[model samples]
Target: MKWASDSITAGQITLLRVLFGFLPVLGYALARRALSRHHARHLHHYFAMSLLATSVFYYAFAAGTALLPSGIAGALSGAIPLFTFVCALAFLRSEPVTLLRFLGVLIGFGGVLLIARPWETTHGVDPTGVLFMLLGAASVGASFVYARKFISPLGIAPAALTTYQIGLALLTLMVVTDLDGMTTLADDTRALVGVVIGLGILGTGVAYILYYFIVETLGAVTASSATYIPPVVALAIGWLLVGEPLQLRDGIAVLLILSGVAVLRVTPRSGAAVSPTPRWGPR
Candidate 1:
């Protein structure tokens, strides 16, 4: 997506996302996997989840990053898990929303505030971009509930689930995408095209497999907590790689976010069992 985002128009990049992102899953979807009539009919649900989780999320994320600093954007993007927890409370009957988890989410959001400091800067961050980031976070957050409520119960393996999701996303993207812009890739240097391949296969495709499994194993809110990592990484990259200023607030924000995640891992007062059972066992 990073590579395609450079040369391809936003509309084109959205289309190429399906192309690059689906490459890793091309064979996996075709591999033998039993599909019930219900699973077949409900495929649209998975596609819809993917649409928001990946496609829409990508759109908002791209727009946000284009407008905001990397650290600020990453910090804001970490809200996905918080949104996931809220969605879980409202939607999933199984998501146990203990005081600790709720408080932790609050703490995390507080840290996000320190990291973002939206009040401190109105110069660089556009309201539209901030709205896009929030939308991306919300879409990703909702995706977790959608997966837990709709997809997990279907007794589908994560790999197979990801396979079908990506394959279907590809088909959906094709219908709306302009084919003419795809030829622009021919003019791109080999390195740029290779980056596109890497981003598609390694970043989007493989990551979805791990992400879906995590959602299956840990529940959406727990799995979504992994969102905390990117902000710290983005801060580091911005400082070391890009020479962006690393403020004291950034360090403090990182510590607070980590603490918030630790708070979530604390044992519940009831000490309820949290081990997850995947609906479909490995083939």
Candidate 2:
């Protein structure tokens, strides 16, 4: 959304994040009769997770995209699974450890290494941008782990959780947002509105709905492994449409991410025990 970055600051984008990303979701949740005040009551249990997952996730991402090439940003997203794997292992102790799962985590991280290639300045990627990507990845990673632990145990419906999560995120964004940045949208209302709505509905709303699906069905680590795909797609878009050069390292990074995800997919075969237990009521 940096097309308007010249006019808008990241804080302003974050303020809009509430409207663009979560408001439609809240409306959707209410329309489906999926949310209520009672759900909000237990929301404190999920408050931090939702906050990290959505608000912090998008804020850092807005900064990252503003500063970095879309391809590099995509590659950085690959860090989510790795970060989640570590988070789950350390924080969400319910997930069992196995050789294959460990191997998958390592393999995925190896792919991230090839993509980041911090030693090279060939692409002119901004270091601050890379840091933003990592922070975003870490936020999502920790949130996923927390979801499987604290949120899933509540046995709340995924739709309701989506509503609450996005709702909480909206509230958090409001606290830090700058209303004056709205002046930037005066020039390009369509692109600005479109960016907000598209990202809000598709990226944050629909995306997280699907995300919880994987979190529930597979273990959290497996769910996090999905992170690897977006970077490859981003790289392709950058190369084909945006005219960003995809270096040979980028190509190898894609292959490694594919291989890493393949390894992660194999994890579920031996990882059934680690899957979040799906008993029918809250703990």
TM-score of each: 0.82, 0.86
- CA lDDT of every candidate: 0.69, 0.73
- Model 2: per-residue Cα lDDT over 115-181, one tens digit each: 6677888758788887898899889989888888877767777778877777777777777786775
lDDT of 1 by residue, 1-283 (tens): 3334555655566556556777767556556453344567777887887687777776677667666666666667777877787787789776666788878778877876776567865545466666777889889889987887788777676767776777777777677766775677667776256545655677678778787777777777777777868877777777786676777876787777666766665658644434222343332
Clashes found in each candidate (C-alpha, N, C closer than 3 A): 0, 2
Query: Against the true structure, candidate 2 has what lDDT?
Result: 0.73
Cα-based lDDT at residue 187, candidate 2: 85
lDDT score of model 1?
Answer: 0.69
